[model samples]
Target chain A: MSEKPTIEAYLKNIEEGHFKAYKCVDCGMIIAPPSGSCYGCGSSNMKWAEVSGKGKLVSFTVIHVAPDQFAEEAPYYVAIVELAEGTRVSARLLGFDPLKPEQVRLGINLKLDYEKGKSGATYLAFKPA
Target chain B: MPLNNTNIVSAAQTKFGALTGVTLREIFSEAVDKATIHAGIPKKDIQAAFIGSFIPEMLVHQGHTAPLLLDFAGLKGIPATRHEDACASGATALRAAIMAIESGLYDTVLVAGVEKMTSVSTSKVTEALAAAADDQFESSIGLTFPGVFAIAAVAHMQKYGTTEEDMALVAVKAHKNAATNPLAQFQKEITLEKAMTPRYVAWPLKLFDCSPISDGAAALVLTSNEKAKKYTDLPVKITGTGQASASMNLCDRSDLTSFSASVDASRQAYKMAGLKPKDMDFAVVHDCFTIAEIIASEDIGFFKPGEGAKAVRDGITALDGDKPINPMGGLKAVGHPVGATGVKQAVVIYRELIGDAGPNQVANHDTALMHNFGGTGATCVVNIMRRADL
Candidate 1:
């Protein structure tokens, strides 16, 4: 078994532009954002595995009313991206017109990217590949 | 025999809306007063208390609320506990109270849910509600409650050909039902054009699609069946109660079109009651968002998958429809006071079951179901109620 992946480490990797997920040592299933136990096999034995950072947009929403932290960045896109590793994660969908959701089609391929928020914090993001 | 050992002697709620200047303790005590008076039971008879209030510590700067609220209501010194499951907090408290009675621990207990949200700003309320979602995965990425349901609305629209108008129709029905409900927040019917005209809160979910942040509270007095006769002649038997959950994050879910927790919870309740969806005269589900109502209608077996939208369009879920849903305006028009909503759902159903619902009453109200969920379907509670004589 390899070292267990922590959210801090997973996020630090994303900040460094190297995205990774936790893979169950018993079932070889990829778990994103790190979990104590794998949902598939219920295994606590997991290791870090770098994902291809490529996925398709399963669903998306243009947030016009955001929480206070992201209030300045209203009218941004938040989407559920189905990673190529068969797991899904929520990330900002960049490179799209927020005002034109009619044109943003689902199932469109997207590659991993990052966006610096108003708080000067790095966030996981994606754009059209 | 069904699980009919426990009965609700009475239930009551404050008019849900932006109740300005009302403190948490005041509203909760008001609800408790109304319920105990209606039940014709002395406050001293209450053995314990289970209260539900979500985010009050943040919104009102008050925690350890169980005793505080109970003490204000003049029921001080009884064992009390606060239950929190985001929007489902009230129902979770009710479930706890019911179990306490069923376990032979208490003959009668008080169950109440309250939330004073209008005291805070909208953004602050939004941030507080976001706490219900997974902070690391969903909320940190900027997912508001409306955004969470908007994602589901988009997925359902894609797979079921459910148009935005169909979603708007739900708001229309909600407003229509609430028009006659004197206690409802939105008491006037809205045209389809009006419902669709509101600006987007999230893509595909307009301003009218989401439930409002309001201040209110609801209370119920539950007693064992043997002791129920001492209170009221029309006690409503709680035949079935079910609670289930799913992945907290929407991304972890395999499908967004329906909430599996509702399905599982309703199934458990139905089995316990020896009833089916068809047997339920109506349902008051958690319609925190318009799309959520559509999804819940199908999830609880009132309609097949992808059929809930059509049901709304056809007026099949209206107050006079074959299977009336949200006959008392629901959270959409009734105003969702977070913790109060779950208990309020039971309050509405209990009134309908006992023929106490005024102008908003449905023709067929012998049996009903109340479904309440917290945080994008992560926590769901369903309770089936029937007239005691039945």
Candidate 2:
């Protein structure tokens, strides 16, 4: 059997606009990539919460040399993001020609970007708002 | 002291280090031969068998090698099964054999652990081991086992004021013990000054803090007290065997300083043995990284949580100390051949209890424990033994 799509699908979703998510009604917990149930409250009480597609860049690491699968995108930044609703997420940060930690501010507003990979998977990416 | 319940009548191991001239199967055969000879028992006498192996396919492109190797070793039709739990594979297998005897499944069993790590490149080995971690989170971040342990070391220093010197002390003691162990990988003692000179594999963890990559095998024969008499007059009984598991992802943990798995497993073993950590004469802990030993000592109740680092600094865990740890050099110096490590640690304690540990023997040792941890403390098994009859 073949392996499941993981990081590949995630990145591809960022490249496309069809990125969907969910939020817990009771605890105000945001669920990235959407889920049938709330991971926080363990309740089935969830609703389709359309994100503003905006957040803050929490932290990032610039990979000078990427792995074989990501070699073409060498020198990219993988950042952990805190959404406007206070949920944290991880995604590839785009728009900066040359990524640097100093350039990536802690509270800088981030706008969502949709990206597509060679595998025909659409995913979510991020850029400075 | 004599064995408390199940006894280890005989123990043997391949010449550990970088095994260059033999395959895993051959190593197991030799170890089985030596163990049976030492116990003065025939192959037909072993009622059951357990084999421990990790990453055989990655190292040798072979799977389902355990039963086949047992058959090759002349135990053609015994109840044999393979055990896999990362570095704790061998120890867990031994614990299974002990439990089988204690539970009256079989009167006698054979336990063996083997790994042929030298056949693979260092990078491939690292990659294979990383699979034991949270592949989606940790490995995705390019965090190797050393890197995971490095984070723990940094957390220890940050939370408990553990210094680099404290970490180096563990390496120093492990090497000193290995200096006298013929089967140890780096059988030479190193000074604390040399250990502190860091060549970074990961931040806050130096090359010296890591255990050596090794290839080896170890085997032992286990039996009930009644049946043990048929083979040998002296047998080290398995007093207590315990195991525990935890969250695979570090991000899910509330605290990073101590492995809750080790704490629970050791507690179970101590309870089963009707003893406390304070009653132990000595121990052999999983020291895949120097920081791991320090943290594990505290988690297993040897010392107060934060005091283990201080204890190391004070020369309290040395072979001559009140509570010696890893007297057989540990994985740091003795080598971490994964599947073989847990069983090998048991062999060290069995020899010591039998007055056969040679130069590494602690003075007047009676009770001992072996801690085998799999992957950044995700899984753990603790076995307590004594030189007394049940």
Candidate 3:
């Protein structure tokens, strides 16, 4: 039998221009950037679903010594955002200038964006609301 | 409980920390010379070889280079094999030597680990080290080894209330231990004030809290128990060795306060050696980062979780403490030449067990443990050994 379309595949399909994730069938737990399995239940039987594309800014760090690939965007802000769906994801917390760790605070709404990649890898990002 | 089955008669090492112009073969040759001299054995005695290295492709652009290096080291015809398990390559090499001696396939075996990390740039070194983690899930997320350990530190602090002061104590003690160790990379001691004031490398981790990028090699001359007695009256025996691995991704675990692989491997080693943590007179646990050392102290059952840091602050982990650890400055002070760290730990254990560790030796030390972990605890090896003459 042919394998069913993965949750990541389904989310990437509908996320051609929009950011989205999934919710658990049992505990309503959310998996962000879309995952194939539920961490809560360990079930592969997950479904692609849409989120509010909004989250809370939980924590952040200013990566001054960026990786080689991310060197062009040196000293960028990487933050953990807890979506309205209650799942946390890491991304470049945009719409901020010369970010510092102390500047970030908990319970700040964050918005997600979907972007086409230069290397055929779809990208997801978040920005302060 | 007698691992009189296998013994290491001699050991040697190359100067660690950034050998700028040395070739891999040159490094191996230096190690070979030192081992032969220490063992008082001829080069012709090595009947087999086990070589350990990480990222030779990036550093030297060579694959299957062990046979060539062993040949150049004058062990051309012996069965030489390469062992790579990220940073645990040295312990793996030692394990291979032990197995060979125990199997009666080779009466004398040479186990060496060589890595030329300085041949690459700083960024390249970071990238190469990341290869120890899962590329698809961990590295793809731009998570470097420092970031991985940083996450663990955060989780441990959140769960166990470990403080920055606790982490600083680890660096303090390691530096204190390294100050008296001639072979240590940083032979100067730093006070807790200095360690606490350093520039941050990652959240809750500073530059001094981490092991320096080092280039070096280490080698051990393994002989059957019978042959070891002929070389030295106090050759250390291979009492117990155990290795275990855990999930490659840090996000895949239920708890981050302790390394599951370390706990499991230590349990196995202790059982095999017929001993417990309390039975150990001293130990050298992996301290790639200060927090790693603290967590290791707990995982090895030296302290309760979250209590390791307190123990350090309380002076319980000092060299004069009841359960001294990392008396040779550990990876924090001595430097961690990734592939060479495991064997170096063994060498430290050898020194202490023989009461040859001047100034740093625990009084009356008999049995000791050496714990080495690879890539954020994804792989761990713990060995327990006692004075062979005991």
What TM-score, over all chains together, does every model reach?
A: 0.98, 0.82, 0.86
Q: Give stretches of model 1 more than 4 Å off.
A: none
Chain A TM-score, cand. 3: 0.73
Candidate 2: misplaced stretches above 4 Å?
Answer: A1-129, B1-4
Q: What lDDT tens digits, residue by residue, belong to model 3 across residues B1-390?
A: 545678877777777777878888888888887888655888888888888887788777888978888888877888888888888888888888887888898898888988888887888888888889866544554556766676677667766778777898898899899889877888898887898884766655677778898888888888887688777888888788889999776645546678999999999888888888889888899999888998999999888777888888888778998888998789888887888888888888888888888988877588889998888688889988777887
How are the candidates ranked when ordered by lDDT, highest leading? Answer: 1, 2, 3
Candidate 1 — what's its lDDT? 0.91
Best by DockQ: 1
Among these predictions, the greatest lDDT belongs to 1
Q: Which candidate leads the pack in TM-score?
A: 1
Give Cα distance to truth, residue A5, candidate 2, Å. 13
Q: DockQ (Cα-based) per candidate? A: 0.84, 0.12, 0.22
Docking class of 2: incorrect
Candidate 1 lDDT over B36-70, as tens digits, reads 96557899999999988888988998999999999
Compared with the true structure, what per-residue lDDT tens digits does model 2 show for residues B147-253?
66765776677678887789899999999999998888898989989998856555467789889788888999988878878887778877887899986655344
